[model samples]
Target: MYNPTVARLTYRALLGRRRALILFALPALLILMSVVVRMFVGVDDRVAAEVLGGFALATMVPLIGVIAGTGAIGPEIDDGSIVYLLSKPVKRSEIIITKLFVAVAVTMAFSAIPTFVAGWILNGNGQQIAIAYTVAALVASIAYSALFLLLGTVSRHAVVIGLVYALGWEALFGSLVAGARTLSVQQWSLAVAERIGTGDEITSDVGLPLATTLLVAVSVAATWYASQKLRTLTLAGEE
Candidate 1:
């Protein structure tokens, strides 16, 4: 189902631009803040949890997901360059799968790795805080990539829409609104982190069973829908 050529082109499209800078900047900020915090407060599990959960998983991961996932296909569609790609003999599903893989990889590298490094630095791996959030970032990467990729395929304003969802739904509503948490990729990934990480350092709004189911469902459904959209896609001047 995966196409290496499409994956290669998608990676080039994603990383060879200014969005690449944001990818680098967010992780750099996370690591920098972790060092400053550790130097000042010393090691504390609660502090580690706050840093990893509040910023890394909640903010950085989704932001990177928006950039990577939407950037994977949005730019091409916007520039009317996808017609060339669609004219290929490859199945639309393969293209979506390849782009999804690229998006997931980019998200994981830019978000999850930094979360782990920052987590370790925060508490020196105490209470397995770094590991937990890293796992959280990893799973969140997959779901966010698929979700935002669908947004990219379906909307011309994919990046803007993605930012609102990531910042608004995830960063704001998920924290304050009790019901929104269940629909959040952050909460679902936190469920996995809750399973792996020891201590109160990690928690989730939903249980493991429900979170796992939703995470898998969202990723599959989004990818499937994106494929369907691409299969029926029509560009300007098409007959």
Candidate 2:
């Protein structure tokens, strides 16, 4: 297997220094919100589920994914540091795979872990809500990372575009449009959660089998396409 040194460089750049703060912020906010909600509202599973669903899964997960996935490659591409990697002997496809791996890990760590902790704080595993959403967060992390990693490799405005898709399309449109629910990562993940949750605590517009298929398909396809895109990746200018 031809390894990618570019991938290593991409990981260092994405995770190093200032960008780590953005990664920390999202999860931190989730935890903080959980604490505040617990203090004020006491231990209510419904409120906990709502908070975790509305804020943690809907808002924090996507934002962290945008930061991790796009930041993994976009800044390098923008600043032309990608040229050094492009000029190397490593396979570009390997670069994408490596970066995708890093992005997914980062997303999982930042989003999934905190979501689990927050869920516990909110309701202490009541009706298995914490575990259910945690699983959903893990699943969502993989898809979000792959999608935004591809966006990063291809677009200069990947972060902005990713945020818009995550926030505007998924959060906003999915909320307002019943049909849009079928296309949402949030809803898809919720489908998985619904199976794990007791009663009607966690529900989704899509069914378990369909959501499972879409989640796996999207994550795999996006990762594969991202690797393909990176093989033909063109560096920006020396200008």
Question: lDDT of each prediction vs. the true structure?
Answer: 0.92, 0.84
lDDT of 2 by residue, 1-239 (tens): 33456556666777787988878888888899899999999999899889888888888888888998898888887887778777777666777777887888888989889999999999999999999999999999988898898899789899899999989977787656899989999899999889999858787889999999999999889888877776666432333
TM-score of each: 0.97, 0.92
Model 1: clashing residue pairs? none
Off by over 4 Å in 2: 1-8, 234-239
Error of 2 at 200 (Å): 1.2
Best candidate per lDDT, number? 1
lDDT of 2: 0.84
Q: How many residue pairs collide in each prediction? A: 0, 0
How far residue 23's Cα lies from its native spot in candidate 2, in Å, is 1.4
lDDT of 1 at 111: 93
